[model samples]
Target: MIGLAATPEVSLADEPVRIRAWGLPPQTAITLRAWVRDEKGDIFHSRAFYQTDTEGKVDLEQSEATGGDFRGIYPMGLFWALKPTTPYRRLIKWDVMGSPFLVHLELYPSVLLVPSEDHLPAVTTVVERWYVAPGVQRLQVRDGRVRGALFLPPGEGPFPGVIEMFGGLGGLLEFRSSLLASRGFACLALAYSAYEDLPKFMPTVDLTYFEEAAQFLLRNPKVSGDGVGVVAVCKAAEIALCMASYLPQVQATVCINGTNAVNGNFLTYGNISIEGIPYQIERAQTTHSGAMQLSFTLQDPRKPEYQDCILPIERARGPVLFCVGDKDQNYDSLFFANEALARARKKGKQNVYLRRYPGAGHLLEPPGSPFCPVSQSPFFPLPLMWGGELVPHCTAQETCWREMRDFLHSNLAPGTKSKL
Candidate 1:
């Protein structure tokens, strides 16, 4: 008889699982495979080759993968190393209120180059990964102009508030915000464009709309803070910077792998309008995979003509955390972050912090999320190369997520007890 098991079987998405196998031949070579289907029905899977111990047991916590998707003693490697069955299909969870992802684990008798349906597995098991913890509440918000889903932690008198925003992909993304609520934050996954009745594209960004969302979050009876934090990635990060600079209600900002300048859209606030930095699409290179490498496509904002495009982040009333992936193929995120740092320092702002991750990508999601270096873009004809090696990128995601949570707790909640 053979057995495979994942401890607890069900847990939060960020929580680690210990996988072990037994009842195999001593010192036998075997393959461990993990597979899960996304909300869109796209399958993602990973496999690793390992050798059993003298006692005929294999523990992911102790054993190292000798071959396959990843090497080394990473207990959760099977989760993060998952690659799409079809190229350029990024894994995204659209339904946070639904059932958790059912990850199927199988132990094969031999080391197969690809998962074979022809042969039965020696052992099989399943694990459930959930974004929302038990008792967390999810509420849809269609107030005024704010279109989002608000996630509130359970047993809360009032919780620290955070507004989460995603990039140019545009629709509301709730997975990260839902996970934040599980960690004791009242988070709003806000959508600016391409969702419901919102604009189809962001040709002009109205800072007033974000201001309205921030105001609405602060007015919530379940939200404790007089001010809120904004966590944004990609093009939305630029909007976060703008909010931090212009909105006094935005007390903290987390900018992840985003530009410091107005990007590809005019930012408007009353009489103030900042022109977007121009993109040299002609300079973009197409890789052999047919994905466009856009790292060098955006014009430098520091240039004399584009100086006006740079956001005045020194005007921000609170500390700003800038997280950048050094190997970001989406754009020069490190360069933009450093430029923002310099500009802030020049204006005598001392609360700005920069965290740089080596070999990481543009989509630095919460831990346990798959590492997608390239994926098809909803806005583009071909795929986009987001850029990063799997191991280092996954490592960065784990580390960055912890730090980001701590940062939010310290700045937004202060004396409040944290569930993380």
Candidate 2:
């Protein structure tokens, strides 16, 4: 019989799973395969080779990953890293936030011995989806100011609140906020532009709009914190930092792969005008592997424009977490993080923490998400390269997911911790 150690249902994407096979011929060689489906209904598969001991038993924990894109002993890692054989596309898509996916595993003979049964041994594992937390209220949030969904976790009076913003791609993505709400925090996926009812093109960012979102989160009856936190990625990361600096309601901020300066178009705050560091179109190069490279400031930090573009994040309040990838091809995440850290430190602030992942790419997605290498643009129409190879990319996703959850929970939710 083939079996799994943990429950057939798992909650976290990076949770460890143990698999075992026994009752077969001693010293037998076998192949184990898994199949799963994405929300798009795309079927994906992964297979590995293993050998049973004299006792006719094979424990995946003790086995080495041999024959698949991932060559590690962790079964969960194997499933997370599975890729197609032909063009090597991701075998699974873990981006269906709050939705569950089913997985099937089968054990087949490496070399058929005597054709005993008509079918191979099989087992099943279910990854359950997480919706809003019990008693949590899911509401449509549309005001003259903010446009997004608000998820309020089930609770009595007050709860920590967070305002989530997506990167330059611009549409309001509720996955992160929904997942966070399931973990016991009120989260709002705020959309500023590029979606229905929002601006079609990027505009000069105004902090007032984000400030309005923060105020909205704070006013929620379920929201308990003195000040709300902000979660943002890519270009939005800069916006988060700016909010933390300008808005007193922003008690904390998590900036991922963000720039140190006001990037893209110019940003305004009343009479104070902040200059943006424009992309060096000429310096942007594409690798032969089809990944577009960026002109990060690290390549030339001394450039006169770099100094002029830095944001005054030192004025921000509360703890800040800067998560960045060292191998990012999108921007100089490491350099920008360092600049932010230095600025915070220079201001005598000690709550800033910089978490750097080496060998990882620009795309630091939530846990269980299949590592994505290329992303399509909403306008210009070219696949932008998010850095890092398969192994490190997935690894970064797995770890960063937990880190983000804990950071927000610990800082925002403080006394009340989620069961996760």
Candidate 3:
């Protein structure tokens, strides 16, 4: 007889689970597999080979994988190592509020690197990974040019407020906001473009629109503090910096793998317009896998000709946190981060902070999400390589997420303890 189990079968996506097997043959080889379907019905799976202990037990926390998707004793490796069955597809939780991801785990009697459909599992179990907690309420906002979803914690008279934005794939993403709300924030997942009646492309973004969104959060009755924090990644991170620089209501900002100088879009405010650093399509390198490595496709903002492209972040009224991945293949993230840091410091600004990850990618998502190094990009003709080693990228996500929460809490809701 063989048994498989996942303690606390249901858990938040960021939370860890304990997996173990009992009643297996001592010293026997086995294959453990995990599979889940994305919102598009695309299948993503990972498998690992392990040997049962002398006591005929295998604990993911202690057992090491001898072969398969990943090696070593990473308890949650199966969850993060998932790769899409369809080439170039990236796993995204499109309907985060609708349902949790149903992850199926199976145990096979023998080691099989690529298990066939005909092979039946000796034991199996299912686990649920949730983004929104039970009591969190999600509200769709379409208030006066501010189009997005607002998530509120249960029984919250007031909570730290956060405005979250994603990169070039401009659309409202609720997973991060929902998870933050569950952890005690009144979070707004803002959509700047490419959704509903918003602009179709990044080039048309107006700074006033983001100002309106920030004003909405500042005026919300459920939101605590006089100012709100901004959390953004990729291209949106540049916009967040703009908000922090010009908006007094923005108390803190987190910029993840973003460029210091504007790129791919012209930014406009009331009377000021800044030209973006143009993309040099000729510089894009095609990988052997046919994916495009776009790290060098943008004109160097540090050059004398592109001075206007640099954002005036030194004028920001709040503390800024810049997170960069040295292995980022989206652009030169480290260079951008360092440039921003140097400029802010040269201007005598003391609140700028930089956190560098050695082996992470362009898409630094919340923890427990699958590590996606290469994926199809809407902005390009071929799949894009985001560039990160698996274990290091996963590690960066987990560490950055916790620090982000603490930074927001400490700055936006001073004197309040972070939930982490």
Candidate 4:
């Protein structure tokens, strides 16, 4: 039997998170256990066990890959040490480290009473065939002369609109945005830097450009035109938050793994340059031993200069959804969520929904890959290393998908009560 809601003081970092194993006899092999996963829900955590001595000392051991993280390459032999393995429950596993004699202990947030109703959709086939479903329309739009693709649901006299942003490293991946558009939305995947002729490197981004994009989406007939919603990931997350604060057309915003404040220098799109961004971000470096490189802003979060970035969360005119990963080494998703939530509450706003996963990392969506962080894979010392573990049986992937879908539906629903 395993302990329920047991809080273990372990941080799942670059190396496998270690725990102080208790009640082990010296000179004997005992199980070492732990639980971890990444955002995409494709990988699982494993427990490798080491032997113990008679002096009540148990070396952290390894075992077979017994939990959710290893399902992608399972049965024949995923990789597991002779260490302790975890048991599976609610799609999450805290390893007894695959030891036949097992026990599980977990802490808050990592422990959710997953209702059985929320299982992975039986449609297990990979998404290969792309469809321009029921209400999707192709439109070439410009934000201050920068052109991008837009997808709007047909037959909508007036519907909610959303402006989506991909990572600094990827292109306008129309596949996912089109899916959202099919679900009755005016979705646009916009790119500002890194790709084709946009900009040679990560250029300074402007909140006004997204503002213009929102305006363009609202003006479209398919969109409700009242205002549009925004979704952002990685570095773009902060820009989405800024959109909600500075732009009137933005109603609901979802931010994942992004900077909370405008700590970097302002980005210039076209000839117009927006200023006041603190130049404080520093990038992390990675190592061959699997440690990540980290880049972050130098501005202190506690200072007034950084308040402009913090002001948006407090001033957001619409609802917000934040998805954070506890083990995410880059973008401190959990911390950002809490900070934003606190700021919102201080301003007497209560419409913030924050979801936290223990081992989920950045870059788990819209193209999750095997790289430590696919963006940093090419760089020698990968920047902003993270530690969110992808679970097997697709727990993180499935759960995050469900939570995010519900959040968008509930908040951005058609004909809800919003003054806009």
Candidate 5:
């Protein structure tokens, strides 16, 4: 008989979950694989081969994970990085419908073989919720015009507050916000469009609405600090940068795989109209597998009309952290980050920082998320190509996640220890 178990039983996504196997044949080589269903009901699987010791036991912690798309003793969240061979099938799919992806992990023993339903071992299930954390409370946000959910950590007093937002692929993305709360930050997943009671699509919106949301956090008694921080990914990063520049209450900004210039169509504040940078779609060369591939290439920002779209980082109240990937397919994120840094430096601002990861893709998710090389279009079947290989992507995710946490902690809750 072969037995497998994951230590700690319940593990957070940013944290590692150790797997141990015993009761197998001694000194024999075997294959182990894991299978789980995504929120879309697609079954994804990953497999690896390992040799059992004389004791007929295998501790994954003691050996490196080899013979798969990833390798290393840990490989920084290998469990979550197992993606489907079919493109556009993401390994780490965030729930945009305000629900958590509950992953049931099953380790199967088989011959040195490929991953398939037939090869899956008949065993009991050990389940783990992907982004849900203990003691994190999710509250529906309906405060007047403000929308989305608020994730509050379990504490009596105030905590550092953050307003989390997603990019053009709009929806109520609460996983990251809720996870941040679990790590001790009061996070509000703000939805500007593409959800219930919000705008059906990205449109010319008022920046004052966001300002109102920030004011809400600052006024909340449970929220610590005099100002709030903003965390955003991709297109939303542009919004975050703009907010930091215009909103006095926004003291810190985290922009991940974002553009230097404004990318949204138009942002209005009274009579002021901020036009965004324009971009042309460049479809990636599709492979024989018929996988979807798409990339957005931005036009020249030096143009006279585009000049006004450049973000004024010198006006920002606090430091900015730009986390970018060199291989970002959506846009020139590295170039954009460098531009932001240069502009801030030219303006005599020393608080601007940049972290560029090689071989990493457009999406810089929380640590331990699967490396999604190809992104599936939410509205259509065409897939968006996400640059980067598995190993470096995993490493990038871990490193970026750590740096991001530190950035927020230092800016929002300076001199305090990480709640990890």
Candidate 6:
């Protein structure tokens, strides 16, 4: 977690500050360690890392999230060390887009003492009672300990299910998956790291938990299980794609800003043969070249040498919707997604939808972010990748929302088990 900020923040979300405040006032403080991150940047310094708001007090550090999905119910904030007013840049790294990035922030007013359990969140719900949409919600099954919100859409007895995968630091804020749930779909914002009982560092893990979570969500009475879908961001995006090609229950996938490289356990893009995907699929594209140039050597996008894929993306059995930001210096996720789509098409599969944003960056298309929550925010710029471009409001963001809705409705359909 090196490569710290040379300066600090001293003002509102104007630009990077040349100097940092002298003392800790009545504000809250946070420590950040992700590069010019993903998922709703330009306003909310989101990364799903860790927070100390144990007392539930929104301190000065607790700024608001800007407009995107939910209009403004979920507020987000970021605290970065910077100079007083040096015309801030959201630079978090110098080289690659998907590097082992880090940009720390030790928020002020130090709220909670950060628990040690490392479990999911300290939250829980009966699930059945927490129906996402009116009668559309169902609880055919329930298992596992979790703390967070659930999103459900309106419908009848059966519906498709989708799981939201993100790294430990990328906790389950229930922003995206919940949105899908609202649309008559059963979506669980699954969290893995940054819980109370896990280590403070990252590690090479497996997809067992994700698999179990998917299985649970699918078996839920509300879910049709015909085609369980998943959407992951950043590192988890990699895992999501792997699951798409491997998980049997996974009907469709909308993998965002994830690496195509493979891991020890998860099946990667490069490793999978025609037997896995059986085809290639186009994700999305963008003018942002930083990410494409970032490199995929580490991302071994290959499936494990398993005899079968629980749910293969090639067999998408349903459909895929790829979304990426053009300004996503991390190699416009759209382009990367498109790369996968193309491969699928070449193999005679055509169930992928790739969408790319023009000026938007990573995680810019999240659902239901607390509106205008960028104040008192931390500017984490992709320093070296800035390329002299400013963060502009992109059209891709808006279209993506509509595209997602249409894609889901047309693909998942009503009373279907996520099957084709």
What TM-score does candidate 5 reach? 0.90
Off by over 4 Å in 3: 414-420
True lDDT of residue 163, candidate 3: 97
Q: Could you give candidate 5's per-residue lDDT for residues 66-112 as a string of tens digits?
A: 56645566623446566765656775546623454454555555554
RMSD of each: 2.1, 4.4, 1.9, 13.7, 3.2, 15.5
Per-residue C-alpha lDDT of model 1 across residues 1-420, encoded as one tens digit per residue: 788999879999988899999999999999999999988888999999999999899999999999999999988899989999999999888888788999999999789886667978888999999989999999999999889999999994588899999998888889999999999999999999999999989899899999999999999899986889999998899899999988999878899998889978898998999889878899998998789999888888878988888999999878899999999999799999999999999999888889999999999998989999999988889999999989899999999999898888888875443222
Backbone clash pairs in model 6 (N, Cα, C under 3 Å; residues 3+ apart or in different chains), count: 112
**Tens digit per residue, CA lDDT, model 3, 232-271:** 9988898898888877888899999988887878888888
Candidate lDDT values, in order = 0.90, 0.71, 0.89, 0.52, 0.75, 0.43
User: All candidates' TM-scores?
Assistant: 0.97, 0.85, 0.97, 0.62, 0.90, 0.51
Cα lDDT for residue 169, candidate 3: 82
TM-score order of candidates, best first?
1, 3, 5, 2, 4, 6
lDDT of 4 by residue, 268-321 (tens): 445644454555334454557545545443344667655544545766777888
Clashing pairs in 2: 159-224
Runs of candidate 2 with Cα error greater than 4 angstroms are 1-6, 10-16, 84-99, 111-126, 129-136, 295-302, 413-420
User: TM-score of predicted model 6?
Assistant: 0.51
Per-residue lDDT of 148 in model 5: 83
Task: Output the worst ten-in-a-row residue range by lDDT, candidate 2.
Answer: 85-94
The candidate 3 region of ten consecutive residues with least summed lDDT is 411-420
Clashing pairs in 1: none
Candidate 6, residues 1-420, lDDT tens digits: the string is: 111222332211212222122232233443221123322243223222223244433222343322212121122223221211222222221121112223233322222334223423222111011113233332322356443334556655475667776532443455355446656567776666564443334344445556777766766676674566777775677677767766666667776655444422334333443332222213212234322222222222334542243223475455666776665543335555766777678767777666655565554443211112011212222222211111232234445666666666566664543322
Q: Stretches of candidate 6 above 4 Å error? A: 1-149, 153-157, 198-202, 263-315, 367-394, 414-420
